[model samples]
Target: MAGILIIAHAPLATALRECIAHIYGGCPARIGALDVLPDSDPVEVVAQATAEIERLREDNGALVLTDMFGATPSNIAARLATVPQVRVLAGVNLPMLVRAVCYRTTSLDMLVEKALAGASKGIQAIGPGTPAPEYGCSPTPCAEAAADAAEQAAAGATDNVKAASGLSAGVLKPAGAT
Candidate 1:
């Protein structure tokens, strides 16, 4: 499995890790997160990130996820691009991180593809007629089923939830699921 590192501004990195832990019942192995504080030293942060990457990287190398392009975190992450087998992706989000974690066991190149795809697909504009409590109504069963069907159709015609979520068969389970 490739190592996965999340580098972002203060609190976001740690929070994303915590959220993953919640989703998967626990944070999976070969994962590390570093929060870059406003007052942090760039040199020291780079050293720390390199160490973490070395420690976490396995046969598949590592994937570094950062917040924004041209920011401190991305700049720090960019430094790792020269490292053999490492890829840096900016604009980290929950869906992107989840997809990366789910697909970490794949080849490094495949993992990058999955992460970028997840980042794009996770974004959606909720418009009128979508059943959401925020919109003040539950979706009818038919509407929900249609939505599920459409989503599955969009997921490369895969019916398996795990496949759609970028997980291998029988690999991961949410917290408290049997």
Candidate 2:
């Protein structure tokens, strides 16, 4: 399993980890974070981040998630990328982190793909909307419609039901079915 290292502006990294723990009951092992203060020395911060990345990766490689590109955190992540077995991604979000942690058993490239997919799918411009009401429609039609919407929320969903609903397709399956 590849370790996860979150490098972001101060508090964002910690807050994201906290959010993950709150949602998942607990944060998984080998997941670490470094909150980069705006006023902090970039050189010193990079040094600290390097050590954290090394510690988290251990013998395995690491997936580095940063809050934004061109930021200090991302800059450090870029520097760390030169090191062996370290991959960096910008625009880190809660969904991305959750998916990364869940699929840590996968290969580094696969995990990156999953993370990007998760992050992109998680974003949605949700607004007030009501489920279509059909006077002659039965309950089954509504259920089927929801399932269809999930599957077709966005074209080319390879990793599963990563829709605006935020639920995985696996959740709809019966135990031992897969």
Candidate 3:
């Protein structure tokens, strides 16, 4: 199984871990969370993070998740990319973390794909008019709605690309005033 490390601003990393624990009823092995404090020294943080990476790494390698790109945690995570078998992904969210934890037994590359899918699939517009199923209120119904939404989103993206490139199989709109 691949190891997972979460590096984020103070408290976010630890909070995410705790949330995962809450969901899973227990914290899984080979997972570490590092909270970077405001007054943290980058060099020391790197050292500490490197040590965590070493401890978490296995045959399948380790995955590092950070809160935001271009931030301190992600910058620190960037330094660890040179470490063999470690992949760093920015924009850490609950869905992404859960996916990474659940698929820890898979190959590192496949785990990355699963994590990315989980992150994107987890995002939705929830409002008054949105269906409860799409809001993930129930397991089976939510899964079905989510699957249908994913399919539609994919097809819509394809159509959008085609239209943008003037290759759509439909009448092209003439440039005109709104």
The candidate that achieves the highest lDDT relative to the unseen native structure? 1
Candidate 2 C-alpha lDDT tens digits along 1-178: 6788999999999998887667555666688889998798989988988898878884447999999999888998899988888889999998788767655544577678878877886677646784433855323211332354456656655443343223242122212212
CA RMSD per model (angstroms): 6.6, 8.9, 13.9
Question: What overall lDDT goes with each candidate model?
Answer: 0.78, 0.71, 0.76
lDDT of 1 by residue, 50-158 (tens): 9999998988789999999999999999999999999999999987888787666556887798788788867777988756676574333223323444575676664
Query: What TM-score would candidate 3 get against the native?
Result: 0.76
Ranking by lDDT: 1, 3, 2
Q: Give the C-alpha miss distance for residue 48 in model 2, angstroms.
A: 0.8
Choose the strongest candidate by TM-score.
1
Model 2 stretches astray by more than 4 angstroms: 58-60, 130-178
Give TM per candidate: 0.77, 0.72, 0.76
- Global lDDT of model 3: 0.76
How many clashes in each candidate?
0, 0, 0
**Poorly placed runs, candidate 3 (over 4 Å):** 134-178
